[model samples]
Target chain A: MSLTVPTSTTLVELQDVHLSFGSNEVLKGIDLKVNKGDAVSIIGPSGSGKSTILRCINGLLIPQSGKITVGRTRVDELKTETERIALRKRIGIVFQQFNLFPHLTVLENITIAPRKILGISEAEANRHARDLLEKVRLEQKANAYPGQLSGGQQQRVAIARALAMRPELVLFDEVTSALDPETVGEVLAVIRDLVREGMTSILVTHEMRFAEEISDTVVFTENGLIVEHGTPDEIFSKSTNPRINSFVNGLGGRATPLHDGEGI
Target chain B: MSIVLKQERAKQLPFGGIFAAVLGLTVIAWLFLNQSLGQVLLEWLPYLAKGFTMNVLISILAIAIGTLIGIVLGVMELAPFAVVRAPALVYVQIFRNAPHLVLIFAATYIFPFELVIFGNYVPFPDWVKAVVGLAIPASAHIAEITRGAIQSIPTAQWDAAQGLGFSRSQSLRWIILPQCIKRSLPPWMNLYASITMGTALASLVGVHELLHSANDASTAVQRTDFTVVVYLTVLIAFFLFCYPVSRFTQYLERRLASR
Candidate 1:
């Protein structure tokens, strides 16, 4: 399939990205560009390097050979940890585990980066954190530690924490996979709100319906390569690629293997 | 209802049994070893109490220096390069494996009594030597504790902190070390207790600490019959000082864990 470049200005771009762990290659010669205000969903079977792509974008896992650019920052070329940290401030990531600082309160968790990394005043950071908490509908839990919150509440707080940095790009790495079925909607609803607000984001998710509804672009990966990329409707319903077809057919909140008794 | 039931169960604990047992032991000891007890308590105990300050001073100095060294060694142990990690590993192994008494004797005998620093000759006492000896071993143990606590924190926290733009030091200071403090407290208390006990070894090198003072008082009193009373009083004094510290450590551990 031919890759179509979006008309809007590019916010993130990955060129011929390749990453491997020991002998197993996770991402191979992948190319993708995310334009500003666009929400892209990466969906695939378990080992399709879907999460690895998000991790690469966020600099959690550096690509061995690739050019990853976020805005004007060439993330792959960052030589120092100091430079990487400065680059990371422009990008936010929400993890599946909702890795909130359990030692800190909800307000502290959200306000910490702004105050510590950005060197903002405590009063200013707290004010911004309160606004983000109110946006996530969790203003009352400002003093509550992450341990006291439910899985969904914790994920929302994580999202709020990410947003409090005012990052130009946000990445969601299976944010709902660890939550209970009933709680997934709250986290997804927060993402949907982000899409509505035209925040640039890349989400690796298994929820096909949410992906279809919110994503401006849909990417289907199989065996470390993007096999299909297009508008959500075209890729979700009108895809002709056999691998993409099999993946969408198994889109009942799970990625079924294309061949019986064989893994992806 | 379950919370109320737990509170009630805690209230109904058999504290009276513990009180009775302690009282019974005290009475048995008093009856069996009663001769010259008043003399030991009134005369010698005050003299022994005089050395308590020295004991406290040694412990404070040793811990302050030891903890600082321990934290540095701990970070070094986790360093990515072998050049940085090797010396820390060697220091920990040598210090931790050596006996505290041997270490104290070696420090007192081997280290120079006076050193010139900044063009000034500073005299080093037996107490300073003893502290150095205790601190070396304590630093090794604390290094091991710090390393374990830092390693026990999940890698995901590190990744999350990095994703939020925190450098290695920033992640450690704000995210990793704060979490480690809860895990490290109990071991730190245990180390301090051992160090406090190790301070008793200072008496061997003529530091005149609590045990040394007790020995001198016992000899001056010249009461071989009151040996048990004098020694037991010293034991009680050490126990009273250390038990409260351990209990407070446990309390903090439980409280932090619940949080």
Candidate 2:
């Protein structure tokens, strides 16, 4: 598909966003940007606020203070649930738990949002859903309930369900974390294909090697702050920061030299 | 494993044993009565049957009305605003804890016997008042059941629906309530059985239900043995009606748990 906006255009920008739950601060003065069609990955340890950033970008969590601009809308200024819902409609998010509606068949899960919110005809919605089912390589499971599918298959259906909205950007929150080890690859492969198709994506994930392989930019966050961000090569292989080197080496189990232009 | 399965199956429905016990007691009572048992039963069966039908009708009407209002109250209990939620919580708490017989009495005396409709005085019958009386506790119990069922749903479902851009009302209508119905079914059936048994309480208010009919039969017969047989039949009648419902609820609970 052709790019709807110029590749240089910034699709999402967060300026010094800070959010807290009770007294527990999660995101502290964080700034991030995603250019149109760029696949950005945020990686961090548990409780590092990586997933919280994705939630904030999609208006699921509003920052206590700061500007979040997605396309033309100011997310922080969204005063009502109606405005938040409007913002959410344009952005799709896949949860770590793959929260497919257990009561719905896979096809119905994929088609419901388009038919209900977008006012698409049933036939058209089904047609689109079938196409998504094929893209996710689960065409035969369209009539099956989510309970009948494996974890990986359920996550794939969740992705299709999100894509059915034709969202401008999609957020993936550790989409493979809940999967059985053997099944995680299938979900990741589906996401890899989506990234290759030039979809603008922001992912919060723990799959270190996959992030290094797919991300246009890799962001490392620790204790509710972004510690470092750069191209995958810079963050993974060339960064001199002891913490970044330790995190990458510790998670990925790679022994690449910390200095630029140094061999393994 | 086979022994465990047998025990589980044995625990599920003891209908045959209950039936045998009722039959044996009735036969013992018949032997003691010294009159033709079949003849006495044949004469009183039609009247008892009419009263039993009234019991069934009341149960059906009460459950239908209670379910409708209870669902609304259940949803209200979860409303974001305290103004909408507080009254619903108060209603469920008061009615649910109150005695069923007391509610029946309250409904009997509190509501005016006549209702003015279009300037016409329409007499509200005693049985209809009994239905309203029984419905109060039924609605409160069902409201609690509905709330619990909705809460039992994983919050992930709500998040998914919201992330997909479905409004709160739309999510409840399309996604949440459909699941709630399945989860609520077994308890709802259990409530129905309770309400069916509670219909006997209506007898105190002159509703002419099964117990009332049995009371009249005993008084008119003027024999102690005949009274025992009459009241025993009333007990058997209620057991026969409600036992199956409880069994079916168990069946549903098992099916849902497996799924």
On lDDT, the leading prediction is 2
lDDT of 1 by residue, B158-227 (tens): 9889999999989999999899998888779878999999899999999989989888877777777566
Task: Provide interface RMSD per model, one decimal.
Answer: 0.9, 1.2
Q: What share of the true interface contacts does each candidate keep?
A: 0.85, 0.66
Candidate 2 CAPRI category: medium
TM-score of predicted structure 1:
0.91
- Model 2, span A41-81: residue lDDT tens: 99888899998999898888888999999999999999999
TM-score for chain A as predicted in candidate 2: 0.93
Which residue pairs show backbone clashes in model 2? none
- What's the residue-level lDDT of A91 in candidate 1? 89
Clashes of each: 0, 0
lDDT for model 1, on a 0 to 1 scale? Answer: 0.85
Note the Cα lDDT for every prediction shown: 0.85, 0.87
